[model samples]
Target: MNKISKRPRTTLEQKIMILNHHHKSQNSQAETVNHFKTKYSISTSSFSEWLKDEQNLRSLYNNSNEFLRNSKRKLNFKYDKINKEMDKIVQSALQENQVINEPMLRQHWCKLVSIYGVQDPKRISSFSHGWLTQFKKRNGISKNKKPIELVENDYDLFDSN
Candidate 1:
């Protein structure tokens, strides 16, 4: 049987230090993972998790700063104008008996993806979901619908016109 080493949980700060040290030493992520596993007596999985946590924290910190900047730039919202526009759209959709379905959204999204020449379905799904959620939130619309499965054929054989 192999040895089961007890790896201690290292702090986020320590993980950052290890990452910076490896970066300064011109080491790749794989090399750093291996090096940390041996030098710090930590498991490879733990090191990988630490790296992911560090990257996520960095992204969140950057996004927070961006949001702050965006908030400062919004001087004229024109709430009434936005409400009128949304009301018009809602009335039009209701008159046409048009309901927004996942397949329709997926089809529309696939057209845009094809126009942009993007082949990654995950990227398309994430972008579509983000836009839909943001639009719903802005219009004060309820988004309690079930999650939709985006199939490979949804993009491959879809034509939105």
Candidate 2:
């Protein structure tokens, strides 16, 4: 009797990664299948099985998009945290009548990443002038002024005026 070999099981994450790679590449479907088969040691029959599972393919697509969205969210959160910290530092300096410039801001960011042990210091340090400008615009923060603050009894002050 001939022995039948069992195919290796793959995780959803691995499947998603493969599908994303295939989606992003300029290769045709057949080329992608062949590439994945050779690279991952998967058989063409197994690839066919994967293709036949509509639900699995849909899940893979959704999961891939979700992965990208989550990555973007994490990066945005990092940027927001950096922006808030920078605002605090700049506000403190302004109180002391010191002007904070872009170079100073970049230095403060480097110091913050070093002190706080950010996961990817390079990401934090890779901010270009255009990126910094967009970040400031998005956060509505101005280097020349303190961030706007809402205070209690502001309506009373307006009434008095």
* TM-score of every candidate: 0.28, 0.34
lDDT of 2 at 149: 30
Taking the tens digit of each residue's C-alpha lDDT, what string does model 1 give over 1-161? Answer: 99987654444444556767766998776778777765455566765665677676445335433332233122233233433443455445445645544454455555455555665657455344555554454433443432322232343432324
List per-prediction Cα lDDT, in the order shown: 0.49, 0.55
lDDT of 2 by residue, 1-161 (tens): 99966544444455656666666896665777777664455665665565576475555346443333223122344466676676677557656655445556566777677666777745557556676675455434454454333222233221101
Candidate 2 regions with alpha-carbon error over 4 angstroms: 1-76, 124-126, 138-161
Residue 148 lDDT in model 1? 24
Task: Kindly give the stretch of ten consecutive residues in candidate 1 with the minimal lDDT sum.
Answer: 66-75
Q: Best candidate per lDDT, number?
A: 2
The candidate 2 region of ten consecutive residues with least summed lDDT is 152-161
Clashing pairs in 2: none
